[model samples]
Target: MLATYPIAATEQNWISVTLLNALRLALESLIQGNAAPDFVDAISEEYRDAFVKGPKFQTLYEKFVAKCGILTSQQCAQILDALLDQNNFPAVFIATTTCSSIKDALPEVHEAAKDLFKHAFDKLSDWKSPGSEHTIRATYHQLVDAHLSHGSCPFCGYEPIEADDPDLADPDLDHYLAVSRYPFAGVNLRNLTAMGVNCNRSYKGAQDILLNEHNQRVDCFDPYGNEQVALSLSGTTILSGAGEGPAWTLTFDPDVKSQNWRRIFRLETRLKSSVLEKHYKTWLKQCISYAQKNNIDIRNMDGALEAVGKFKTTCEFETFPTIARLKTSFFDLIEAALNDPVGGERMHNFLVKAA
Candidate 1:
């Protein structure tokens, strides 16, 4: 998971200008009680000339405006709110209108708005302010990096920032809400998340992970939230008093939203099984080695359990996370085995021979 940082004032100002201009024009038309075609013409000119400054499409703009003109004042206000708040405008618009044909018309308006913002952001050119060389994009990343405690990519917990490289590549800035679908959010600070390039660009191209109404709940595992999805080992297990045939598998909590998040990123497929297994094996070997070196009895459950805690404390915090929870769960399984008399004997013998 990732967290958004505060929007820089300059960037916020830049974004505000574009949004306020459009809102001002829309409001002007609403106040005048302009017909659909007239309202469309006024706003389209304001958008194209004042903001986008590109190819004109008067016909499409007329159609989009006509659709908007039919909406009640309350509905129009909701559209204004969407511009400012970056809420689900399409869903809201669709809910307001009974005509299914309006669906095709809305995208033109959204695309124009998206293009306008894209141009303004691109016009900032260097992503830097007047005096400083530090880019706004870099500043945004720095804030997010701090928010994430400078940790590895939250989704996979594998790709970390390359500190030694002079030209370090920052994490890909993913639009939490797809910019193609939710164009109004194209530059919304809250909607952007810094993640691994592969996770952002390849795995989660344009998927709408935030589509479910339940997901918008404050308690859900937001990338910005303090609570994280816990990871563990699954599949056949010998250490937890169950006979094992296959190697353990990595599993996330069965929370449906978490499952959806995992699905969105293809976490199970993308995260290498060998990498997790290696970390578990290494931690286990280190525990057995510590017992041998210090003359601590591996057969003693308390000593073995204490070692697990010590290992977790020593190794969990890192720039590149080594699937720490899954590793801890492996130790938990070992501790469970030690607690059961039959399992304890089996695990003790297994460790003794391995050590």
Candidate 2:
């Protein structure tokens, strides 16, 4: 989860624009197996000239993308806009060259089009100001700030809790980029708007490493190109699945679902059925019902109580709509439990411990 949304650099410097175009071209050629005439036509004379004359284009392009280095929003937006044009449908093929695995994951995407790339490139180029350096930095900062605010983790709206370890504290902005990248793929903002930062970053990354292209079982979930079909909420526990099946059922590449399952939900160990009181029967009943229907086992009383506590602290009181509703539901459960002690103890012993 992120504390803020990310802003995109909608504009770019001339050299950066040039680099993006070169990468798109190279990627397109690699994906399509051959460059389309439209793609050939889309290359700007200036960029084309640079590529022919500059020996370092490939190295520079790779470095920029690898670092998630800043780019102007104008450049990104233009690149995306042009890529989405019907004339540029072929640009998707270029993705294959950029990421070899893309060939199998998104085979249906169209090839990279020349006019669209050229237009996007042109749009970016035109935005260049008198001071290229200052303009680029300003544009980059604006987009980054926007993303930091609006693109927070959907589940918690909490940026990954900064790690104390310097090695881990480094932020992974690209993990959040899933929201933007998907939309950029086909100009589908609807997809972007609906994305959850947790699913996009946490789940996707884990899945990518866990599975290979064929989606077989592995030690981790490789999130690179996986989909999130179901998100299960049990008390404070959040379980995600690739679809309707068990976490282990949907195998493709890494054990993506399982890896995420471990990361998002922690086993509660402090619970004991004996601690049940008449304060949370209703909520307990609901949890039990949900588990029964879903064929989930909650025999571990500690786990159950821990789950209840998790709900109270994380899901119920949080600010998200999902957590907001959970907060209300939990209140009712607590009230019902209080009215009926045995059921309440079974349902919310965690509350008793806190009191």
TM-score of each: 0.69, 0.34
Question: What is the model-wide C-alpha lDDT for candidate 2?
Answer: 0.34
Highest lDDT: which candidate?
Answer: 1
Q: Write the per-residue lDDT of candidate 1 for residues 114-183, one digit (tens) a residue.
A: 6655644454334454455566566666665665565667777776643322278766767676766655
**Candidate 2, which segments miss by more than 4 Å at Cα?**
1-54, 58-141, 147-157, 161-170, 175-353
lDDT of 1 at 24: 50
Report the CA-based lDDT of candidate 1 relative to the real structure.
Answer: 0.55
What are the root-mean-square deviations of the candidates from the true structure over C-alphas?
A: 6.4, 14.4
Query: With candidate 2 superimposed using the best TM-score fit, by how many Å does residue 177's alpha carbon deviate from the native?
Result: 9.4
Per-model lDDT: 0.55, 0.34
Worst 10-residue lDDT window for candidate 1 reads 94-103
